[model samples]
Target chain A: TPFRIQNYRTLAYVLTTLVYLVIGAAIFDRLESTQESISYANLQTRIDVFRQQHNMSKSEFENLTRTVESRLNYRKKQWKFIGSFYYATVVLALVGYGHAIPYTKAGRAVTIAYALIGIPMWLIMIQSVGERLNSLITFVLKRIKRHFKRKREPQITAMELLTCEALLTVLTLATGSYVFHRYENWRYFDAFYYCLLTLTTIGFGDLVPMQKDDYGSIGWLYILFCIMFILTGLTIVASSGNLLILRFVETNTKRSRNERYEM
Target chain B: TPFRIQNYRTLAYVLTTLVYLVIGAAIFDRLESTQESISYANLQTRIDVFRQQHNMSKSEFENLTRTVESRLNYRKKQWKFIGSFYYATVVLALVGYGHAIPYTKAGRAVTIAYALIGIPMWLIMIQSVGERLNSLITFVLKRIKRHFKRKREPQITAMELLTCEALLTVLTLATGSYVFHRYENWRYFDAFYYCLLTLTTIGFGDLVPMQKDDYGSIGWLYILFCIMFILTGLTIVASSGNLLILRFVETNTKRSRNERYEM
Candidate 1:
């Protein structure tokens, strides 16, 4: 029924993911253009102003570029570290590392406040992920029930679970290699590695595929590549998420039966 | 029989996750201290450093403090933006943006090489997550078989799923809020926001709660939280994985039969 609780919830999840994905893509695309502009005349103007203010000669200007480059490099590495810190924190989901922000009291106050807003935002996200999962679980359970309804040992040996593993490997390999080919010249093993990292989202940023020489022309293609990568990542996570839910139900069910029998 | 494959795999998962949590916590604690030291000089030495670097009078120093404070505010916000970028890259499991790294051809080459390395590193991780998932699936399928082997249906229903959800929620909340309270004076909601972000690894770092405080004082506690939160996440994923496996097995069984009948 259109109003069934599960159906309604599934509809909501579909709509939300679709909406968020579109919004996210839009924002990413806008940012990509903004980043492009940051290098255009505006940034050149800012550099010229800074150099003039410093009363720099051409040689001094070059020296200053070296110094600035060094500083930028240092900052790049530092910021990358911070970025990695963010990656780790999020993966660990601790959200406690303050290296990404101020450590002062006023800063802390704002941080605390932002966190208050962020918490529920995350909770909403979790609920959405859970709802998606619930829908999936419902879908799977129904399928199993239908199979068992046939009322036979059904000539199915469960060892075929290994076959699923085989299928997963093949799929992972095929998809991984294709992505790798488009982004890099990795061998099969390396392609598999890229797939692993991208799918899992470890995202060290140490191993990102660099932006190609767009020659200012491939920007749209690059954007498309990124957006496609994000969607592919969601699929991998969704599949992995599906696997994780299966284990949870199994463990809990056993624990409960054990407790009851013991009682 | 003494060393069942399923049991061994579960043990491996627990051990790997346990080890990763330890290393993750240790690194974070050290990083916190290093970052805290960046602004430190003891209150007395601070005067000397300020005098030495910029040659400021007390009044001038105080005035300069305003500039520094404003700069810090800007930096904090900027860092949070960077952190958010890193997070977006991580969760999507694909780093597309070139914020803190090279965007040139040389840079792309580096990224490609780096990705080649990163992919396998990620694969190893997937294998670990995969192992845990496999055991969990086998464990659940065994249960389902026994469940149907019985004369009664055991009243399988949605209520049972709630029990798992409750555990996941509690486990997340307990670890999340505690770590949040570690460095920030956030309300419980703030703590919760921090927790949800951390668990899901969405990691919008605008509200980092710890670091620059307590170093090793709560090191063990921090580690414990990481272990618990991720385990809970993994467990939830496992439950769904089990359901999907069952469904897949059923579908394949049916499809193969249908093809044979048509033939």
Candidate 2:
């Protein structure tokens, strides 16, 4: 019966998520579909004007458009050493920005092989670091409590660690946004969006940083900083998520075990 | 000392992974960079020829190219109800195909808010489903073993479970590839690559499905099937990864605890 209850509970969660996704889909469609149509029409008009200006036939215009589109996609040098390294990190992190994807068949094959091993390795590494970070935070919290001469021995609860992680996440986002704003010359809001997307690993690539041909100077430093920022931010979030999920599963298992004992 | 050793081992893993990434980057660069340059040059030549043929000035051609690129990006109707649902699933999974990202500021803002809550909830739900899947497989394997009437009790080992999971994953890939190959008209290899990328959640949108306006009569069926395939594939992979990481962490923790006890 407990097993059945657990299955039922999971089913409920799945149903709820489906509803949530539907609501989100509706909201996104409402906010974006009209804008998408307006923009699409504007682009169509522009293409039509260009065709008329050149006295070009439909087939000729289509051919030129195909050529120009492919050319525009590669305007930036995305396969150089540094960019390639960036691509490697993105793949390992499962961020897959699509800004600099593998263009050749061999590249795709290698990507598949590389990701098969790299992703799990990366996950373990980040999560290992995250656990350590959690311990370090817990130790520091305990010391702070001791310094305050608290009446209790100051055992750090999961809730406390969670709050600490949440704070660190916000701090990381704020600092990351400011840094990207300065380096990438994006508006602050856009930079914040970029940082959030990267941390979540959603990485839509709409506003990827380090994309310009010229980073002025200290480009390597900026790139290194960005990579480190991504790694470190994910660790913090992983720690937080780890705590949340483990506590959740632990509670559920404990409840079910107790119920079984009662039965 | 054991604590220090654990830290050192984690550090070693981190360093090794860095080296691995560097090697991969070199390989990818070597494999793909020359092609990139060749393609880039070819595109440039075509653009130049087109500009000269049209007697278009530099600025005029630049403006036209920008409009064409923007227009080309939206040739697909990616904001319809079904497409939006697909988009929602991608974001929630953090696959982020980027085929149909939010256009308006409101959409982006809502996306941020939605992901903040939805991502963790989705993670928990998927992991729960994955755990159940794992248990179900183990149960079935035990049942099959008992049917053979072995001398010893049919105990399902972790290794056995792992092998089963691997076989299931490969089978999922094979069948998924075939189905997508039939439906989306992609080459078999490309369909396999799509399945691999989707399962890894490193969804490079270069070969996203459902892009064509004409999906024949069973378009909705195809869409539903694709979504189900993605979810099931991810759940299987998550189950495998979960077993792996938990076993790894358990062994490490056991060893360290034993070392502490010895001290």
Candidate 3:
């Protein structure tokens, strides 16, 4: 019942994050659209002035304007609903995949304001879920230890604990690589690399998954699962690292104290 | 002497991180160049084949190929030495601005490998510096408290501590916003937003500072300072948040336990 209560709290947090994201996307969309229209108008005026100043022929002006319009349209198309949502996800998750940027002052302002709230909320949500996963991991590890105790091996050393954590990390990476390679049509190495990048939260966006329209809903689901996997893996890695560092510091301090006593 | 020793360790860590970044950039540069050449060759072959199959005129093919070449050149231009260094910083810091991404399989693999080592190292480095900063903050706060004590207000409450932290955060944001607004030629709100996004490590790259060529060496220095500022700000914010959260959680648990006891 306590775990269930925590789960409900997590669900609430998740819902709140989603709501924040949707609101961000809508605001971004409107802000960007307004900026785009203003820029387009400015461009139009500049083009008109240039044509008039140069006494350009109608056909020449039309050709130049068409080229400009096409370029603008291409830029505009990059901010569609899905793309905007992706941008929102990138910002909230602190990935900042600069594929599509907000060009307007208001858009940039809102982005800063949005991220100020969204990032902390997102972190809290991830940390909450991560804590749960951490407990699950600990429980699983303990069960394995118990099973081993039944076979007459009872003690678990620090090294053994580290190895287990490392093994889990490797397993998670391997599974992610396999699934992404299958779905994203990427090489094994690339998939593995992608898993590492996303898990580390160093999302370069060069090898992002599910960018294709064909993948659709499944792609979104995959991304969601990947986020969970990444968070859990990070928690394990960080905890292990902290343990190691603490041991290192302790040993150093003890050795120095002994040296000082001898002196 | 311990503080001195720690400072030395921090310096060593900073140097090592820089070395790691440089090496990563070099390797990524090479990997990406190889991939680019191969892709260009492939594109050239495809274009030739298409022209041959379509029985296109030489002039028409040349025109088309020139257009394609220009596009490729534009893409290539995004990966200059400085830009790549910036990219490496983005990756290692887990900011991943996605402005300059590794396109090659080898480059991506290296990036993953590099980040696996680099992210933890960066975290350690940030935290090392952060701890120093934290102590400095504590010292400063104590001095401020003592000053108030001299003015006959000796008692310091949790609210006062919280207020002090909040004030520091706001002051940092305001100062950063002013400096960036002046340097980046952005609106005040946009500058503040940029500060928030970056300090939170949600670097959307929509409004990055020190991006103009005119800013030159000064721009680079500004960026370097900004990174330091962001790291320090993050450490302060995280610690303050943690303290607040811990207190909140403790109170909540106490209240819940009391309710259960009453029931």
Q: Evaluated with DockQ, which candidate comes out highest? A: 2
Model 3 pairs whose backbones collide = none
The docking category that best describes candidate 2 is medium
Compose the digit string of candidate 3's lDDT tens values, residues B1-263.
43334334334543443343334334333333344345446555655665565566768544433343323223223344445445555665677666545545445555666566555555544433333333345546666767866644344455666676687788888988898888878888878877777667766665665456566557767866665565557666654664465444344334333221111
Q: Residues A1-263, candidate 1, lDDT per residue (tens digit)?
A: 32243233334543443344344334433343344345444545654664465455667544434333323222222222333333233343222322243334443343344444443333223323332333334344445655878543333222343344345445755765776566566566556555554554443333434323332466555544543443334444443443453344344435443331111
| Top of the candidates by TM-score | 2
lDDT of each: 0.41, 0.83, 0.54
Model 3 in CAPRI terms: which quality? incorrect
Task: Give me the displacement of residue B155 in model 2, in angstroms.
Answer: 2.5
Better of 1 and 3 by lDDT: 3
Model 1: which docking level applies? incorrect
List candidate 2 segments past 4 Å from native: A150-154, A252-263, B150-153, B253-263
Q: Which pairs clash in model 2?
A: none
Instruction: List the candidates ranked by TM-score, beginning with the highest.
Output: 2, 3, 1
Q: Quote the positional error of residue A219 for candidate 2 in Å.
A: 2.4
Model 1 chain B weakest 10-residue run by lDDT: B70-79
